[model samples]
Target chain A: MATISLGVFDWLVIASYFVFVLGIGYYLKRYTKSENDFFLAGRKNSAWVAGLAFLSANLGALELLGMTGNTFKYGMYVAHFYWIGAIPAMLFLGIYMMPFYYSSKIKSIPGYLKLRFGEKTRVLNGIAFAIMTLLVSGINLYAMALVLRTFLGWDWDVSMWVSALTVAVYVTMSGLMSAIFTEIIQFFLIWFGLFLVAILGIGEIGSITEIMNRLPESFNTLWSTSGDAARNGMEVTWPAIVLGLGFVLSFGYWTTDFLVVQRAFSARDLRAARMTPIIASFFKMAIPFIVILTGLTAIALSNDPGSGFSLLQDGGQVNYDSALPLLIARYYPTGLIGLGVTALLAGFMAGQAGNISAFNTVWTYDIYKSVINREASDSHLLWMGRVATLVGVLISIGTAYWAKSFPSIMDYMQAIFSWVNAPLFATMLLGMFVRWVTPNGAFWGLLAGMGSSFYMFLAVKFQWFEAKILTLSSVQSDMAVNFWRAWWAWLICFAVTILVSLVTKRQEEKDLVGLVKGLTEETLGREVPFLKRPEFFALLSLVALVILNILFW
Target chain B: MASEVREMKSIWFLVGLVLLVMGGLVLLAGVVELFSPSERQTVLADTHPGIWWGAVMLAAGSLFYFKNRK
Candidate 1:
């Protein structure tokens, strides 16, 4: 941990935003009038809020630091992973998959499975989703902890607890609506802060050409058609990037993840939900530019022959993830550094608490009450939701510290979660599209998917004892770094689900008319009443005003 | 309604096929790299052209969908 110094002004600016977030959290408390209000923002919110929240949730600490490290290391491959991989996935989601959830009026994805299939399928899907949601909690908490340690030099325990406390407080108090509003504010602060640092960096270094001239060839290694990241059966070539990053990351996110779906579920209507992510997709496209650019600029700045990038220590190879914070601490005066540090907190807490709140509501309403105890009163349920919030925060904070002991915790967290997610996604998509996908068929198929992927992941990830029965030694290599073979996790899961569904002759398919109830009629206006043009124009105006950075000071 | 639904479905199939193709190729390349660990870097560097191909197909598909929507 670095011995950090912040000026009084810096403290004030950082404190100001904290006050602002708390203000929003306290302010939105009035809106949490019921379980629905807390869970889904009363299902009457504007698309823009949903859109902003969706973007903020996606713009997690991963991009703040991990993507910085990624692009700094991999360069354009990171870009391809997004434009080539993620966007099209979102578009696919916006059109084809979203309708199923909206039309069914299901609270959680697992709930939808139960309705479409049966309780057996529901429990399977629920378990898988729970695993993924839990894994993600670990990943986000880990990153938040990292930022706090690097920037503020807080002890791991202190950082974890503070990060957890901030999120737990606001989330338990006000729920998703507060998370959204706070995110919109935090979203602006983070970019503004990052952009400010980026500008300072470029200005400090003088010109782009001057900056570019200072780097080694590796920093700018553009393409590698011949793959180099493959070590001992593990690989991450362009092909792998396309498959793992583009396909896996994209499809997995858009189709399966509830964070964004929760936003869509809360929208005024299906149209608003659809439009929200479109707006978010555009924002998603722009983020890597801001984040990656700041990181690259730090690289260029650090490469100036004698500039050791030692963070005041002896020259060290600049860890690109630390670029944003180091820059904030290095150049800004004390008070401004305070503001910058606080702004980084904005990015950290926005995603962290958002995940916690979503976790609480989903677990309480969808799983606990629905399955564990169905007859709880609303008041009891609300209290249970708050209790879930507290537990979710504690678990995430524990994970944040626990990750310190793991191998490349970020990557491991993502890989494990994908196993949970890949299975459920396969089953859900099949259930939606295939007519003969009977409830019984779906139940077993989903089980097969989860079982196959989990077996694959664990069989390789943990090579427990092997020589108990065989003549071999009692240990073997855990060869699970098979990024390449991991694709089959999805393939096997999807194929098995479909095969099992088709093999077991189910009863005749349910009628499709009910599913297409609102499709043909020009009920876009009636079904989804949006703000009139003037109101939309005014919303745009507010957004423009918020981005006062672009035109004005 | 039938016409629009047909158009959307047709495009969906077209796009899905292209995605599946691209996905297959990537999987092939990934499989190749599993045995050739060091070759992983070179494989991903080769993805831009494939990405470009996917992008072009996506654009063309979107155009087809939009053109028919009217």
Candidate 2:
């Protein structure tokens, strides 16, 4: 494996990125005077700003690299993650969920829980979310450092510390405002830096049709081979794809996860908030052109004997994650290589910033202000938000070092999401749509859902029971087990909430006015025409989604 | 008066500034490489992607910068 050495021009491009982000943070600091500004970017961003930031928060370098790598491994089936797995949930968030979330004026998702359920459920989710955010943030930091060290021969400790410190300074300066600003910039940098690889790869491969023809039958079609697990690279049937990834995991993360939803929370009004995820869906649908196409191009090149292209192998195993970096090394010269590296660096820092900002909000509003100091002033809480940003970054640094020691921690990311978001989605769904859902039911049902998901993960990992029992299939992939486990967890949470609510007392309808669906008054976009509504855009996104699936099928 | 006081530079303007600076540098490097090519040429060095891509960035950056420039 060759190391990617940065020349003077490359260094300049990278240095410019760092300067701009820090400068933006310094500039926004004065305007970030209020708690709302610190926590939610002043609630003043347009739909476009919030929308790109919303998508960019989740579009980390690890996702870029890993998805491209997974495409090389799983073929077109990996597109399920971006398409059926994400777009539907995003549209659902904009169309059905944003009204409740935005209208409540809650600082965080946990704040909404406190209003709808009780203090117990809110605190439980707050604590869980805070832990999950730090762990994921730290893991991202570790993975970023690892990628730099492996590909560029950079020192791991330096990579980790420098990137972490940079994120700390920017995020602590103006909190979510700086985070959103950097994320939107990162969005542009990624498209400019990485999309070129797809274009160049297409140039090398002659055409997308030629690239598709070079692949084995198992790797080409999206849904055609999904009927039987044996016929596809993913080794899972359509049911698992639809139920697990599309419904449970996608809805859970997109609608409920505060990291992305907080971007929408920053929008100036309910209409912009609703439009945030709707606009984001279009971009999210387009990302596969960068990742998936480049991956198929990698496969096409490797299959050609005269091309002399092969993935880097470690310990006799082919490293799929090497696909994107190796492609950059193949196509990009000096100046462009620097741009590509900076794009990856921007991604790592923005993702870390997103997590830390989300953590600070949840810790300050949901935990500190709610439980530690109930009558804290706005200015004081704002101060605590900055302090929490520092503490969160430090904890993430510790987590990164821990991940460095145990690299296997990266494999547990999907499991961690299942434990937290899967069950919480069920509770959120019931609590919002069903007015009869009691606070006690939400607390207990969430606890059971999280517990069951974790238990199932451990049961499969340790071989306490055969995984077939959970997956209900003789042949299974790690992804298959993950989807089925999430589905089961969500179902358990849904059922338990219903049963517990039957026996327990519910919140009064008057008290649940803005939080729950039936009790809340619907004030959709009456001033705007039907064509300009979020619903119309969501319908268009859905139609695009259907056409894409059918075309690929 | 209140509106004037509250006005701030949009995020797009900053995005444009960064792109313009970086794109200019890349284009500069590309032209230098064109006259005296680097010893270690990449797989498709004959195509000189840096020049074209840099020009594209410059064009896009200029559009964003001028449109949003207050």
Candidate 3:
């Protein structure tokens, strides 16, 4: 229950961040005259700009705190989220999927569904995505307020309202351009602010090797103990890790999530778009060095009785999320303390902005313009996008209050992803690769997939069936259940789509060109040499990924 | 085709400016704290990380600012 007091220098650092973001927003307003500018940042960013924004959109403070906490709980197995769970999907998206997405020039992912499937499928996805986005955004706001109130002694209402208003001001001004700018800044702030903890922790622990030596066998090695469910802290097997987390859930989130994909859509050219996620993959691989190492350091510190270090516990339950903030309190001086807090604040605000920006675009382009106002003008749609931004933030605030009343809702975030994105990924895969996939097939398959995933979650939650039946293991963690559920949902969707496609009428080959794989021409980065292509970098990224996994194993 | 409008400043330039200002402030605080240390010290306060890390930020910020400044 202790709070860290900020010095004058700390306040300065935090205030400067607010000023910079607001200034950036005000400055970019002129360039944001058109709907393209608001929704897609004018599609003029380089690979590096789009790449960092892509990664930062997903790198929220909640992930930082939770991952670091998860590390303290699950040990090195947590690194799987950053590595196998992410890198391959990112590479797949960049090298394979980006071409179709970019060439079609769709404003949002559901827009692509409309072109490939039908209006019903597009509206179905758009409505699901819009609801899912607002709920997650609201949860993020609640989590941010909780952290601020718990750690800095800030008022919860004030924290929520202040952060929400700041995001609204900036995003409403220039939209995604301002969002991308702030996201890039947040990327730097996170590195400079938090990477120091890993360094200082190593300084405290003597060495990285010493920290590893102090951990239990269940907590240190990544894959060595993953074969048997009983051998690891996560209580899951390698097959679960691979099929569930590594394959289905990973591909479902990374390849299909619009929050991240919107950044790639902002790239200036086709090659840049392809390279966006490829460039992000390298950085994604490096994040574990910050979160995983710090988690390991926390384990090493807590294990020593005389070190006088321990995690906070509330209501007799251990608060694992307190690890990173406690480390900041332990090592950061006055000035650096402010920088650390600012880094976390920037992360929370930028993440909220990313969600709202993506929501506004989907609302304006996919739902409102497509369903409600089919003949809306460019200027009218632009106006609608701004209104959506304000309304989205207000709904997010309302959702935050709702979450405050029922804290257990936070536990359902993974379940929500499985419900919406997992099945949608199956629909996307078939729609993109299989030319004979019918609109009816996609629509029915997606609904069945989403419904089944939700049903599976509720069944296990209410004890309608033993969770062991779903996980196929006697020992199960919530995380293990999530991974397995995503796999089943994807499998159901994938199977149902193929079955229904055979029974349904297919679209003409002419209508499928540039959307489906076999029908589309392979003209991506053809003029560029091997060394300059995204494939070369993706190969390098894959090699790095393999090496890191082997080294950790 | 030469136009009179000034070219828009790059996002990198803005990044550099924010880092430079924030880093300079941190470095200044670190220097002041080095001479007149706070009574409530952190775990490794004797090592003075604020000073060095602030300097690193300042240097990195300078490089970014000068390189990208229009």
Clashing pairs for model 2 are none
Clashing pairs in 3: none
Query: What is the TM-score (0 to 1) of candidate 3?
Result: 0.99
Off by over 4 Å in 3: B1-6
TM-score of chain A of each: 0.83, 0.99, 0.99
Worst 10 residues of 1 chain B by lDDT: B1-10
By summed lDDT, the worst window of 10 consecutive residues in model 1 chain A runs over A467-476
Evaluate all candidate structures by whole-model CA lDDT and list the values in order.
0.59, 0.92, 0.92
> Where is model 1 more than 4 Å wrong at Cα?
A206-235, A310-320, A405-408, A459-486, A505-508, A511-553, B1-70
Encode model 1's per-residue lDDT on A1-553: one tens digit a residue.
3546554444555656666567666756765778777877767656666777777876776667776666555443455544545566666666666666776777777767766676777776666666566567767777767667666776767766766687788888878777776776666656545655665566666765565566554444334321444321122445555565557546766667777678777777776676666666667766755665666776675555565453332256445577666666655433344545766677778877767777776687667877899899988888888888889888876676667778366666556645666556666666666666667666776667657656655654465523222112222122123333335556666777677777776544344322332332323334334464222433443354335323211
Report residue B13 deviation for candidate 3 (angstroms): 0.8
Stretches of candidate 2 exceeding 4 Å from the true structure: B1-5
Ten-residue stretch with the least lDDT total in model 2 chain A: A518-527
**Model 3: DockQ vs. true structure:** 0.53
Return whichever of 1 and 3 wins on TM-score.
Answer: 3
| Tens-place lDDT digits, model 3, residues A79-111 | 999999999999999998999999999989999
Cα lDDT of model 2 by residue, B1-56, tens digit: 01122567888887888789888888888888899888777777888999999999
